[model samples]
Target: MPETLRKTFAKWHHWIGVFCASLLAIFCLTGGLCTIGPAFDHWVSPLPPSISKVFHTPSAESVAVATEYMEQTRGEAPAFLRLPTPQDPVFRLIRYDGNAFQTILSLHPETGLPFKDKPSLETGFFIALHSTLYLNRKVIDFIGLFVSLAGLGAVISGILIHWKRLKSDFQLLRLFSPTPRRALDFHLFCTLIALPFLLTALVTGVWIESQHLVEDFSPRPVISVTETESQKNLPAHLPPEAYKELYQAGAHYWGKDNQGFFLIAPHQALLVPSDGKSISLTRPHLALTQIGVKSWNIAPSTDKNISLTAFVKGLHLMRWATGEMRWVVSLSAVLLWAALGAGSFLLLMKQRSALNRRNACPSRSDKIAFSFAESFALSAFGLLPLTLLGLLWLEWLSPKIPLSLSIHAPQGRVDAFFCVWIGLSLIGLAFSLFRWVGSFPFADKALRLLWKITLKGSVFFALALPFITLLGREWRHLPLLPNTASLLLEGHFVLFGLILFMCIRKNT
Candidate 1:
């Protein structure tokens, strides 16, 4: 690069780094947590004592029986029936109220009825917030876009800063040195080792968040069908059972293996069996087919938009990835958070030095920004792991807590999350005020106190897993793998907290 261009790039990197440091940290931690989204999901879902039998292709009637049972129990018609999958032993009846969708379980295929147990509320809510930030579409899209761009900025600047020192810094540590330079070296070293994982996560995250943008750029094709004269004479409102019969008749056209995935319109249903042709048609088109319709007219027309969205969403979240590939993604998440913390500390140390050399403190605005960032980084991130445990605790103890898609059950566990989180925040606040009033060094006293508290909290939350699984009635049937995963993750947090404490200086 030219010297002038290099200098311009360097300046751009520095100021932008400073500008987005706190927000970038928030992004990194949240994104990292999302990377382990599936594992977190498993932690809170109900784990039956025994695994259920897996069927390759269960009969349509068997599915219908289960569907009918769930509807009767809920006292509302079921919108759809999901096939039993390996992860979810019981078949789910997806229904809708005025507000949100709800899933009711079918105990077994042969016996069509709602399961006695309730759905896992805590897991579902966290998963929703993790994926969508519990917001409307436009807001979520903007958040996704901003966070992605910020991460991109960090990666670009981080690479430039570490390009030369990458290899030599791998061995750098600060067991002896207490200088700011030593801290910088340690931060840079971990970040360099984790660079590839960090970049991959950012790129994937951007792709996931920019899905709507992609759709906007390439809109789905429109499908239009003309109504036949015979169909034009039909009543405006069709019978409710009309959909069900039309679906079965259409399945016959495709042959024995053909099964209905979901219903679309009055005369239309999407069928994709193991061995059958898939097509969409109006009532007239279905009439022409070889399958004899017992009663009501039918139609099937395909919409390309729904399929495209499912495919893109699955890819963005790595839903199809199995086993080891999933682990790779989780590891990337850890690296992402590690990089964020290191990057933020680097920016803070640099600013602190500049102030000391000038014999001046940071301006009020700068100090406020710094404090806000620290508070969020400490409390908000801490809330995440804590909230996760609280959620799992609810799952183990309260299998009967009812949560509908639209219905907000008592939200007992959610209330507990806020209680614990707010309590921690208040304690941190009191400590911060104590330092301020005592005229004690804010950096040393306040920071160290926060660090120690965070470490203890993280350890307790993580360590509680074994006992939670063994002692809790609902969790007794759960497997060993989840417990092991919890321990490993807790160990990582414990190490991270200790490192932060040791790196603390006389000043904050």
Candidate 2:
């Protein structure tokens, strides 16, 4: 390839990659946390002793409470309610008028009253941010469309820039390479490691997001074409007494032990298999029943497109991934973030060296590149790590932070996360801009100190967390087995942590 073409590829990779870096960092961070966040959140959160008593309540009665509460409090009936079961005993009202993340409420099964307001846990907020970005479903789906496309461009440009080294340096990690080149090598290595995962995610992510963005994936469309004749004919509305009878029938047929695994809607009640038993998010395990129905009407989506789409979703979301494999998926996300960070760092260092050489009168592109580099630097070194440390501590410290003060707590610590990222990024950016303008001798030292402290603190905390949690009360809270999976997961964490520790060591 000509030198001009190679420089073009590098420019595309650096600029486009920087723009997506911070956003993808948020995605990966939240995705990784969501896997273990719920478990850790529950482990750290404490229930009020007064309201802590838990016991089984009939599914019908629980749904009855949720519906009544929804009607009385919100002046709108709940579209569906999750009935209480042994594993999760709270009555949850969700999906109102075919909309989610609206009017979600938890109620005591026996009393049908709201639980005391407290710090949000269970990682549902993080899950919501991951899938929907806390925006309207349609908006997020559309945003994902462009993000996936841009991701493809970034990937292609990256490949173009590294084609020469693809074979020879695929597994190469020159720890002692020149400072700027070493970061570049690590970035390339991480890119190679994460390529398969990234491609799979981009393709399937685009497909799934397009379904919702254009077709508007909703309950009506979900069932309209794919549902069976019997299912399409199933009545939606059921009387209160009929609901009770239906519950009794389900209990009898599916075993009393598995009762209440149902989502009650006015149109047709969906009784899904327990979450652990279900792999595909939108396929086979779903069953529909009407008021007088005694048999399960399993959804037979015979359409090949529907089946293929379900499999695609399973791939994109990794719903079928289990045990340490789920950790691998999460780790893939983190590695991709690390690659972006390394590339950002390499660019920043290169740009800084160039700026020092010229000392003044940089081009417009150089200025823009510096701004982007600085933003990515702040995001990579400061915002993400601080937010991670704060959230990590929150996981174990929630039970310790007395909730005696209420009504002001940010929902899910989202306010805290946002504030930290925004504030830290601005401060870091200000320092970089000031240094650029003033060309102060001490500015580099200040920036280096900030970088070292944040990176070291974040990495060390990550290294200590698992070991400490294992030895502490949080260990009892893990929804994991005392088996090889845990060992394998910790091993993966240590491996990644050590790699990061080395990167920090080299940079510092």
Model 2, total clashes:
2
RMSD to the native, candidate 1?
A: 7.6
At residue 157, give the lDDT of candidate 1: 64
Q: Which pairs in model 2 have colliding backbones?
A: 236-266, 236-267
lDDT of predicted model 2: 0.62
Cα lDDT tens digits for candidate 1, 252-314: 665433343332222323333321132211111232111333354445443434454444454
Task: Extract clashing residue pairs from model 1.
Answer: 267-299, 280-300, 281-300, 283-298, 443-507, 443-508
RMSD values for the candidates in order, in angstroms, are 7.6, 6.5
Most TM-score-accurate candidate: 2
